[model samples]
Target: MKEESSVSRLQIMSVMGLSKQRNYLLTQYLQAIQLPRGFGGDLVFEFQVSQGRVRHLVLDEQASSLKEQTVMELIRRSLLAWLPEESRSNR
Candidate 1:
């Protein structure tokens, strides 16, 4: 049906928009962490979307000896701080 197709199109557009926003935010976070005191080694983040939910992995080559929970908590706080006020509120 035309209505169903329109709804599907809208959903696809929304997903794509979210993907773009996520990528931009990730890039900004990466840039912000380039400082020596932030993240010294190669840092990579992988994002996967499934069933409208987004999951992320942060790999820091320099994080050896650091507790996983600690690293994740730091990254989460840093990324949240990097996000816009509106985006932070939405989360």
Candidate 2:
């Protein structure tokens, strides 16, 4: 992982679009682990795999300026719902 944000909203959106456009079999399972305000008000999104590979995306600077509630709503509407079904068994 990189010190800078490894994942961004645009990157995630691009993946979603590519999945559709290319008809690739990709499953993205995202869960809101917790609201870690101590970490500069970041909302943590954890992407888990059955093989024990876990990737986390902390919505820090990208969402730092927004209220907690607003951030949550934005995530729910834009990111969460766009995530593909959990293909844990396949992984």
Clashes of each: 0, 0
Candidate 1 lDDT over 1-91, as tens digits, reads 3543221100111224355666555555545542223322223444454433445634444633334455456665564455543455676
Candidate 2 is scored at a TM of 0.25
- Which ranges in model 1 have alpha carbons more than 4 Å from their true place? 1-18, 37-40, 44-76, 80-91
lDDT score, residue 11, model 2? Answer: 18
For 1-91, candidate 2 gives per-residue lDDT tens digits of 5566523321132232233522233323233333333323345444332232323434444644545575466564444334334333445
Local distance difference test values of all predictions, in order? 0.43, 0.39
Regions of candidate 2 where Cα sits further than 4 Å from its true position? 1-18, 21-54, 62-65, 69-86, 89-91
User: What TM-score goes with each of the models?
Assistant: 0.31, 0.25
Can you list the residue pairs that collide in candidate 1? none
